[model samples]
Target: MDAITTPQNRFVREKDVEALPPPVATGGPVAWMRENLFSGPINTIATLLALYVVVTVVPPLYTYFIGNAVWTGTDGNACRDEVVGYRVGACWAFVWDKINFFVYGSYPADLRWRPNLFFLVFGVGIVWLLWLDAPKRGLAAIYFFLFVPVASYALLYGFPAIGLRTVGTGLWGGILVTIVVSAVGIVISLPLGVALALGRRSKLPIVRLVCVIFIEFIRGVPLITILFMANTMLPLFMSEGVTVDRLVRPLVGVALFASAYMAEVIRGGLQAIPKGQYEGAQSLGLSYPKMMYFIVLPQALRIVIPGIVNTFIGLFKDTTLVSIVGIFDLIRTVESARVDPVWSAPSVNYSGYAFAAIFYFLCCWGMSWYSMSVERRLAASEKR
Candidate 1:
């Protein structure tokens, strides 16, 4: 050690020692478990219990879903335990046979290609809009918000002027109905919700009161009630000869219901914004609309991205409620298909429901994963 002696400070040392490496067990799985799982008696006990439950539960689920699954069959007999000489798990053969019906419902087989094309366009629009680093995102927004909807309507409902056959909404069902309803709700809810949120916070008493009443009334009612009223009561208020399509009624109900909840979510984000933000925008001589568009709304929306995506996920799953109004959504189609006498077997019902569950889980999980990705991206941008 080289010592640097000062007249006022006699205890100073000049040399710096090299830093030592951490203990081998201090940076891996063992350290992680020690720090997180076994940090305390209660935590250690909980971890052990969770591990035991996983051990007990996962293997049986694995066996039922995979080991004993019937992969190929023409009908129910192919999945029957008696015919197979053992118990069975999933009946994927049934899913394979009914895949077309699950996708298209009673949509004419020739016209099925129309929905296929629509799905292709929808997929492209979604990818373009959702990919953060994509080029020309402003153009992507226009394509998604303006072009895709029009194109989808034309493709699905058809335009006879273009020699495409008119397909009634009554013929649409299954996954097609589910997607249409969810997409409409998701697309419509955000803008309408933002409007309502702003209105609720407006200085005008009339605007705030109207928004308050609307949001509360819609929020107070269950979605099923909204669908019922839309289905049975909404027509009574219309012009005597002006009939609303069955699908259109539920579409309106779902959109309105989702909008109310979305408004509340947005309002929460707005409330979280500091008052200084508003004042700063005003200091910049921005008009109310410009203030919101450029300064306030973006920050509020960014703060509430998770809530927005959660609402979307819930709305997507709630498309099943459309079935209560006699719509043939995915769950309705699955319920209808599973009762077929031709495919009757003990495993058929289980398989059909499991298939529905898997589809829903996958869709919801995708939304959740995308939401997390967006949140991470936004967070990174904020840190920068």
Candidate 2:
């Protein structure tokens, strides 16, 4: 007990070892470039090629879009390179002149305030629902899903009793039509798709069979075919004197088309869920609906957020297809305005198309970004 038996008693350091600094050559930009860009001959060459392309392309694009762009002009004459005796790029004046048409289509200029208010309400609802920390989310959902629709309809179509004049769907065009179509498709698709997915997975034969048929049938055809059928064939099938709103037919078609695709995405997620999860929910004495709602679906949906967001992005871009059925969406308005004799110029076409591209890009990017944010938040929660 008096003699130490530990290894520490057997040996002792006579002096401390000198500490050396890490190699400077291995810690800076040079090291990073060697590791990432020039790690191998193939990578080095690829990096050089990429740099060349960007150097050659980006500045010219910048010059065209911004450097040589015509910012303020009244008509085609103002943007004409021949008249100006210089090279011109984008004719932004045309876009500015048609901005109202782009936003509201043929919506009466006097009643445009209604659409502005509609946009404000829609924006508020979107912000409220998307802000995860915001108060009263349940009410926000109600406002977005129920009140927004009713109010949007009344505001756009007008209520005579309230002194608003009636405006036909035929007058609707541009971003207004695009938003309506995209919103309807997105709002209707998710729940409908969930039901279809659940039905396809049901033990009951008839429910599963019907869901399969619907999903397969819709997925088999191009979206254009669905729009045509909805626009033309749907009316023939309707009973005499039963008039369907022109805008609504395409809305139904887009919603159904998106729902079919969304069902497949959700079904993929549902299949990814472990069998043990379902069994565990059942073991807890939960009913089928409660098990799915509280246990199965939440996990499945979280696992497939990317797939859901991808479907949403596709649907958002696909709204442009409605223009074929005489619904003047954003692109359609651009096309119409570009050919106008008033604003007609060499650059007008390019500018109009660029504007359309930018609009679509921003909208799609916003959705993609939001989905990624939600995914990151969910991942953090899982870690905790």
Candidate 3:
């Protein structure tokens, strides 16, 4: 009877539709948690312990930084004399009062807007690079690389003919000095480093010798020594009694030191390149300079992006050392700010330092993020 009924219904018999596959063994959050945080009984226990530690640690940090903080008022008394739960909380009031010191140092109060304008222009240049997607990118690059610096310097240093008052480098402190030194170091080091790397690999013996010695000498010595020597002895080389600008001396030292490190980094990348690449360029009748410039250097630079960025970060942080030579980079400026009797408080010092740390971290992280993104994009282009 069943067989007869089935045959009768054969033209249009309905059956359950196939169930969807079980999500193809997804690597979703639940699966990941299971694998990494709860892979075994021991791992689960360890994760719980870590969470406990985090809980224990985070509250105090929050209390120190935010929960007990005083953000208003003009002086240290706002933090100290106020009737509140936390006398020991962060005194961000001091930071706010001395914010200009941390930004422009002793830059003229009225002329502060000039540096502000320079910063705005610099920001625009960076936005052009990272976001604008402008059609005349080559011109934009030229403007950014060449004209921007001139304009910024003129703005900050003041163009007399334009009625801008001249602000000496001595007055340039805080983040302004730090940014200038680091930027100059990074910009000068890269091309100089590339040149040294090429010279080190040159067939000319004297050229190779000079490059090798320069790199080794610079790399072997400490940056502090180089900075000191630049500050003290650079004038000895200059004719008669021509004194170098205090800022210029540090810039020179930082550039030379960073370039030496950069040279080694680039040399390593040059060595990593496949011999076939060089041979292919030669086969195509490219000159030595043409081959290296058109093919070899680009690949080498890409390969050494991490090292280049690392050197840049180091140079940026090292600019703080300029304070030792009587230049007031951000750290020095913050230190000086904390010493002011009006704002003097334990929390004030910490707050100032914390602000500097956040600023530096933002700059370094932005640089790293941009470089990695560029690297991935370039790799994809090559693949296509």
Best by lDDT: 1
Where is model 2 more than 4 Å wrong at Cα? 1-19, 22-47
lDDT of 2 by residue, 196-292 (tens): 9999999999999999999999999999999999998888888999988999999999999999999999999999999999999999999999999
Ranking by lDDT: 1, 2, 3
Itemize residue pairs with steric clashes in candidate 2. Answer: none
Per-model TM-score on C-alpha atoms: 0.92, 0.92, 0.88
Which tens-of-lDDT digit does each residue in 1-384 have in candidate 1?
235465665666789989998766878898898999999999999999999999999998999889999989889999999999999899999988998888888889998999999999999999999998999999999999999999999999999989898999888988999999999999999999999999999999999999999999999999999999999998998998999999999999999999999999999999999999999999989999999999989999999999999999999999999999999988988999999888889999989888889999999999999989888888898899
Task: Note each model's CA RMSD in angstroms.
Answer: 3.4, 3.1, 4.9
Better of 1 and 3 by lDDT: 1
Winning candidate number (TM-score): 1
Expressed as tens digits, the lDDT of each residue in 1-384 for candidate 3 is 788678666676489788787764448898888899998999999999999999999999898778888889787777773444456677788888888989999998989989888888888777786653577777777777898889988998888988987889989989998988987888789899999999999999999999999999999999999999999998788998678888899889999999999999999999999999999999999999999999999899989988888888888888888888999999999988888888756678788998899899999998888779888888898999
Better of 1 and 3 by TM-score: 1
After superposition, which runs of candidate 1 have C-alpha atoms over 4 Å from their true positions?
1-22, 25-36
Cα lDDT, all candidates: 0.93, 0.93, 0.88
